[model samples]
Target chain A: MIQISRLPYYGRQMLNWGVTIASVIVCALILPSRLPGMELLGIGPNWLLIWVVAWSVKRSVLQGAIAGLALGLIQDGMTSLHPSHTLSLMCVGILTASLKKQRYVQEDFISVALIVFGMTVVAETVLALQFSLVGDRSLAEIWTDHQQIALSSAILSSLWAPILYYPLNLWWEKMNWIENNA
Target chain B: MDTLRRWWDRNWLQVALIGLVISTAWVARQTQGGSLFEVYQLLTRPFQSNPSKQELLTNAKVVEMEAKLQQVEKENQKLRELLGYVAKNQQQAIAAPIVGRGADHWWQQITLGRGSNDGIKEDFVVTAPGGLVGRVSSVTAHTSRVMLISDPSSRVGVMINRSRFMGVMRGKSGNKAVMQFFERVPDVRRGDVVTTSSASELFPSGLPVGRVESVNLSQSPAPEAVIALSAPTSVLEWVAVYPVEKNTDSETSQANSK
Candidate 1:
């Protein structure tokens, strides 16, 4: 196979885009599946939320929000549109980006997982708030349900964050190095 | 003007990419992610449960019970025909494998391998061996999404089969759903069978939903009962999809009801 490093700058950029888009597609595909250990109480990890968190960390606030919005719309397409997923994901992206992890935390699995855990709860809460605003479902029920969802989603997404984060982070870091050197 | 020009020139590629991505996602949302699901269906086709393995899993006892149930159903049909009762037109059901579960934690949904290619349409009734599963929420060319009766947003008009007490049942996000009765003191008891009532415009009446687990008669707004859904939604492998017989009355009622 031809070495990616030897390719022209434009070709390298195109490859970076290809890798990023492929990761998003993979996350989307994995969202609907319940692979044995990945599920808890019939709930799976919030893959899209994890993806948003991953993409948002180390990116600008605007870039993070855009990533969130795009993924959220895709999620809405996968599920119902009334209580849209966009708001929650957008919030996650914005929050993650604004955290400025370089100031306080180091680039490690534990910290990244912690951020994902916190973001998962935030995302679920935002969704619950949207459900409340819709008024179709009872407020009591929404919050009560939110507790279980947030807890499980946080746990699962946190535990699984590194699986998605490590590779994507590596690729983006390499791309950044290549761009700076070129 | 020079600074603005420089910024635009520098960020033009990023701006174009972001716009393209957002517009693509917008198109996906408008089409209910039909293309994505089609790709998902294609990718998952190899992993779908095999029919032969499913057959092996069904033991002889369940088959015997199914045979007996069929006999009783046939007899009940004859009796209803003898009494001149208007028989419901039985539509042929298409069997589909459960290819996926809900994409998110909030919704209780299932993705079936069959779709419009198999004549399944939106709002079609989906049933499993145990009872009513859900209704088809959206359909792609080769895949369809079902909004399960267990979804929190789903509300079904149901009645106690034993007492004929009408109520609206709303899913509580799992196997259990809470039913609020129309009457102040409905004569509902534990273990009573609940089925879709005639007032439900979205579903055919008399389809089995679940059994009442408990009743709280003195509760606040209205009397409520917790129902354990008969369909094993979480573990469902295969389901039957039947076209809903749409009428002008139902359409008007669906609009007026909710």
Candidate 2:
């Protein structure tokens, strides 16, 4: 039989994995919903971006990029495929992971929100760049629209990021603590 | 060999988990998230509006309109018969509740609670009480996604009912749209009713779209008019799906020639 000490460690690892995956599922489910007060200018919070930020804040760049890629693909399925969202989301994940916030900013909701806000802007800019390159939409119109969308998305996503990030982070942190103690 | 084994032992679980997740997400994307939408449809089934109550109350009103419509249709049919014209039959429509909005803001779309099970299909025209809403772009087993008329990429051939001026309507990100006239000096004015023209291949003629809000006749290569969409797109609760004639333009041209 497995030793009692190792049992808790394995259990905690499993629990952490479960929580992480559950959060991703929640984000995917919420993508299509436009519940009251969840909208601004016909836009909703970037749930996938928030998930990426949460995942990357405590992980490595490769892990963050992978999370972004996975979530981006799901989002593309929910939306349209062209001008792929994978690039923008992967950039967000990589940038957030490379921030190494634990060194400069404390591990807290405020910091997480700040990171998400910046990352949202970055992601939107990446998308705008792609749109500009595609040349389907006029540059002036694209940039003007980008300005409005980026500001609104960033503000809303940052404010709402903690609502998802807190519980998820708490669960992950608890599981990590349990594993370490075990 | 020992170093390689150590590396594999340390990273194998993580690699496997990542691979599993990436592949699952990829599969979901490839299938256009049909499974996800099916689950969404199931979860939202209870909340789907029951037509029984509303239908009963609206039955009298609808019957009165139907009677008037029948009278007009009969007159039209008689006129067509006199002219030896082959009258086209109207397709049946299915009513569905608006379950959700677009997954992302960039694309203007809506999720309807009805799908293949209810005979909904891609390219079906969707309209609400006020006017034309959109067209079904994709469908899953029990739910369908609609591309709203207000999407930037969606262009429809429209005409002013009063002046018979023809133009193409393009979405302007919200309830408003911009209509570009084919004629430089087209007769158009504010408050003119816009409808799908017979020239449109995607949509059937005479479906109300919106009313012109303003006109900018001198604005470049094409005269532009801003239109206020008839349907309250942001607050749409329910919509009706009509099976569109796949080649409506060709059929109309054939009728005209005959």
Query: Which one is best on lDDT?
Result: 1
Q: What is the C-alpha local distance difference test score of candidate 2? A: 0.86
Q: Candidate 1 lDDT, tens digit per residue, B1-258?
A: 999999998888778888988999899889988888899899999989877777898899999999998999999999988998767777899999999999998899899999998999899999997889999999999999999998888999999999899999999988999999999999989999999997888888888999999999998799999999999988878999999976444766878998
lDDT of each: 0.91, 0.86
Tell me candidate 1's interface RMSD: 0.8
List DockQ, one per candidate, in order: 0.83, 0.71
Please, what are the lDDT tens digits per residue for candidate 2 over residues B69-163?
99998998999889988667767889998888888777789999989999998899999877899999999988999999988778999999998
CAPRI band for model 1: high
The docking category that best describes candidate 2 is: medium
- Among all windows of ten consecutive residues in candidate 1 chain A, which has the lowest summed lDDT? A2-11
The runs of at least 3 residues in candidate 1 whose Cα sits more than 4 Å from the true structure, single-residue gaps closed, are B246-258
Best by TM-score: 1
lDDT of 2 by residue, A1-182 (tens): 64434565557556567778877877877888877788888888999999999989998999889999999999888888877789999999999999989899885899999999999999989888987888765687668778888888889899999999989888777666766775
Residue-level lDDT for A60 in candidate 1: 95
